[model samples]
Target: MEVKVKVWIEDDNRNLVFGSGKNEILKYVELTGSISKAATKAGMNYKKAWSHIQVLENYIEDKLVITKKGRGEDSGSKLTPKAKELIELYNQLDEDIKKYSQKRFEELFLKKDELISLKEDDAS
Candidate 1:
């Protein structure tokens, strides 16, 4: 058997601010430095990607990316310091949840053999 987990953050208004999809988009944008490029890398439409960024910004009430306009490669986007911090915090939280879930799952679900043996001994 395998374990699966999903994580996200929501604002006080109950609006979703971050999740796996947004994280992928943000990471791709951070790596590519272009929303269009990030959208392509993530196999999403450019408009959809932009919408996702806008939603995140609206929910967080902060600018997560700085846009620059220029000709050719000069035009791209960069993650703000706050954006980087959010990404780091999200990643850390993801790791922590996975670790905790794995440990708990093992303790609760992986002892069937021991449980059966105990039952057998009790019967004997």
Candidate 2:
């Protein structure tokens, strides 16, 4: 089966509010401490990423991520307390889902590749 599986929270319209796009941005933002770097990681331009971040900020009515001045000559971005919490939660949930899905898939599909038996009536 061709399937695109995703785990996310939906908005009032049942649209994904936290999908790969947003999560990837968050990961890069956390890693590089720069919006530019994060945008690069996400295969987007810095200006676009900045605009997206602004949209997110406006949507939640709070700063999900923050940029700060780097010490000694450079500036960087930083996650706010809430952003950290959100990241931690996402990590935990991702771990749990991966563990569960792996176990379930193995148990159901990898045990022996059992054959499917057709019903006697359907054989006619």
Candidate that would win on lDDT:
1
The C-alpha stretches of model 2 lying farther than 4 A from their native spots are 1-5, 68-74, 113-124
Candidate 1 has an lDDT of 0.85
- In order, candidate lDDTs are 0.85, 0.72
Q: Write the per-residue lDDT of candidate 1 for residues 1-124, one digit (tens) a residue.
A: 5467888888788778788778888899999999999999999999989998999888789999899988777678999998888889999999999889887776776776443333555777
Alpha carbon deviation, residue 110, candidate 2 (Å): 2.7
Candidate 2 lDDT tens digits, 1-124: 1113466767898855565567678778989988899999899998878876676666678797766665744468877777777678877877777777766765655535652334687566
Deviation (Å) of 18 in candidate 2: 0.8
Q: What is candidate 1's CA lDDT for residue 110?
A: 74
